[model samples]
Target: MTKIAITGASGFVGQTLAKKLIETSPDAQLILADVHQPPNPTKSSNVECIAADLTEASACQSLVSRSPDAVYILHGIMSSGSEADLELGLKVNFDSVRNLLDTIRVERPATKVIFTSSCAVFGRAAVKDVASEADIVPYPESSYGTQKLMIEFLINDYSRKGLIDGRVVRLPTIFVRAGAPTAAASSFVSGIVREPLHGQESELPVDPNIGIWLSSPRTLAHNLVHAMNVPADKFGHFRTVLLPGYSATSGEILDALEKVAGKEVRSLVKEKRDENIQRVVLSWPAKYDTSRARGLGFTEDVGLEQTIKDFMEADK
Candidate 1:
């Protein structure tokens, strides 16, 4: 049986990914690890849930003791929270990840590790130019981005040394996220669509013309699983792959919402730009040439309107 472990299994993406994995691989044994239990933990006998502090070395050791064949590393501090609290960010994002890596190296060397990174690793320079596989030289603009870059490098080094089979997928800002607002700097990207559709007023933290690189939660979850199935040889030298995404301005997203949900829903979005939010959002690149990920058989969302429609249908 394939044994897999997923950290941050309590979060939205983790929950979705767990479900997807269970559906696709019915016989696979899953160990879901997080500080708090997931809201709807999998009921399947093949799935096991472990609540523990990943920042603690003992907890990390225990989690890896199962010797999972593949581990999905998804835990991290959100962008705004990371920026606001550097110490906390360092502990959760960097320290915890290092602890996990070390534990895996000692206990389960050569195991496949799929890390969920973000486009925030790119900065203002990347924003101005369309980022590609060759162009992604990370000059992080935020504490969160810097931490992710450092982990990417660490994972790469570990992979090169044959300590682990690491696959780093740098995700775009996933939109139409379900649940309450998060401390993520990109939370507004989802809120602007989700809140209005739920008949709630949503705040717009950036200019209407400001564009962002985006993918739907469904697409990201699919790609995460795909990353696991791809052979290690597929990623020759660099294990990092920037996932494919579409670029849309705030105005375009609003227009799509209006077209699908009607003008009433669109009117609920309030223009209240926060400078801090703008600074972080603006630093992220709006466009990417993710042919590399596409070549690897990863998929992309059709358009912004379809993504909004899917969210409405799924949430309602």
Candidate 2:
């Protein structure tokens, strides 16, 4: 049986990915590792949930001791959290990742490592400036972005040295996230839509015209699983792939929501701009040319309207 290990299994993406894995690969052994127990742990006999402090070397070693065929490295501090607490960001985002890589190098060298990176790697750029596979010189502005870029470089180096088979996918802002507000600067992206639809007031922390590259939770989860399954040969030299996503401004998102849920829901979003959040959000590249990822069979959401509709249906 194929053994797959997923760190940060308690997070939204991890939980969804775990369920997807259980559905698609019932016989596969799934080792779910997180500091806290997964909110919705699977009942399947093939799945094992283990509480782990990824920042601790011993915990990382224990997580990889079983030599899983594939490992999904999904743990990290969010954007604003990292910016607010630089030391904790470095510890969790960089130090923990390094420890995990070291453990994998020593214990399971050939195991496939799928890492979830973010579009934050790109510095402030115009909406017309579309990032592509060839243009991945990360000029990160936030501490969180810096950590992700550093880890990406490390993953690439490790993969080059044949120490591990690493695949990094720089995810766009995942919207309609199911949960309360997170520490991420981009949390407003989801909050505006999610809260309003739930009959709650949501705050918009940036200008209505500020654009962002976005992906639905469903699409992001599918791409993560697809990244794990793709042949190593498909990635050639560079291991990083910028996943496909569409661009939409905050105004457009609200417009789509209004179209789907009605004008009242859109009116529930209150504008209270936070400079810190705006700075971080604006620094991210708002456009992308994910031709490489598309050719590699990574999926994209249909559009903002469909994505919002999907969120509504999923929540109901």
Candidate 3:
């Protein structure tokens, strides 16, 4: 069996990825590390859900003891939450990254570490037609982005030193995220559309003109698996490549919603501009030059219309 260790296994994306892994990768053993234990965890036969806070160095050290062939580090502080709690962000997002890397360096240096990064690492400056894996080295705008960028740099530096095998995949904002809305700045993107589509009211935290990159939950999960299994030589010139996503303006969101849910449900979405949310959303990259990733066998999103369809189907 191919043993894999994953942090944030209880999260929306994490849970979805875990379930899919269980169904598809039959020869894979999953080591699930999370803060709270998964309720009724016995349903999964191949998973070992361990309750441990990632902020603690000892917890991380002990968690990495499974000696898995690969590790998927999906844990990180959300953008809005990180901005709200500086101390927590520093300890969890920044410090935990260093601690986790150190643990792998000491105990499991041979294991490949697959990191889930974000497009938010790109700053306000507009790059070429589409941002490439090479463009992620620019200055980041937020503390959360800065933290991710710092970790990417550390991963690259450590890889060069032959400390560990690190691959960071910059994920686009995933739509139709399951569960309660959290502190992520991009949460509102799903919130505004998902809530209204299910015959409920939702608050649009930003204007309709705001443009951002997005992908479906299924695509996000598949991309994670792809990054883990893709040949190491495919990286070519750049180690970290910005994932390609459907570039949609907020206005396009409404159009897509109307097409999927009819005009009646579309009206349920209310526009209330929150400056804090708008600031973060506006700073993200509008598009990415993922030709390198595509040529290397990475996938692109199924467009915005299909993204809405996926959300609608999941809600049913």
Q: What TM value does model 1 have?
A: 0.97
Order candidates by lDDT, high to low. Answer: 1, 2, 3
How do the residues 1-316 of candidate 1 rate in per-residue lDDT, one tens digit apiece? 9999999999988988898888888888999889986544566798888897999999999989988999999999999899999999999999999999988988889999999998888888777678986776779889999999899999999999999999999998888788889999889989999998888999998999998889987788889999999988888898999998899999999999999999999999999979988888778888999988988889977689889988988896
* Candidate 2 lDDT tens digits, 1-316: 8899999898988988998888788888999888986654566888888889989989988988878999999999998899899999999999999999989988889789999998888886433477886865677888988999899999999998899999999999888789888888888899999999999998898999988889888888888889999998899888999998888999999999999999999999999989977877777778898999988899977788888888888788
- The estimated TM-scores of all candidates read 0.97, 0.96, 0.94
Q: Candidate 2: how large is its RMSD?
A: 1.4
lDDT, candidate 3, equals 0.80
Winning model by lDDT:
1
lDDT of 3 at 235: 73
Q: Which candidate number would show the highest TM-score if scored against the true structure?
A: 1
Candidate number that wins on lDDT, 1 or 3: 1
Cα lDDT of model 3 by residue, 67-88, tens digit = 8888888887898888888888
Model 3 ranges off by over 4 Å: 39-43, 127-129, 135-137
Off by over 4 Å in 2: 41-43, 125-128
User: Over all chains combined, what TM-score does candidate 3 have?
Assistant: 0.94
Q: What is the lDDT of residue 12 in candidate 3?
A: 82
Candidate with more favorable, higher TM-score: 1 or 2: 1
How high is the CA lDDT of each candidate model?
Answer: 0.89, 0.88, 0.80
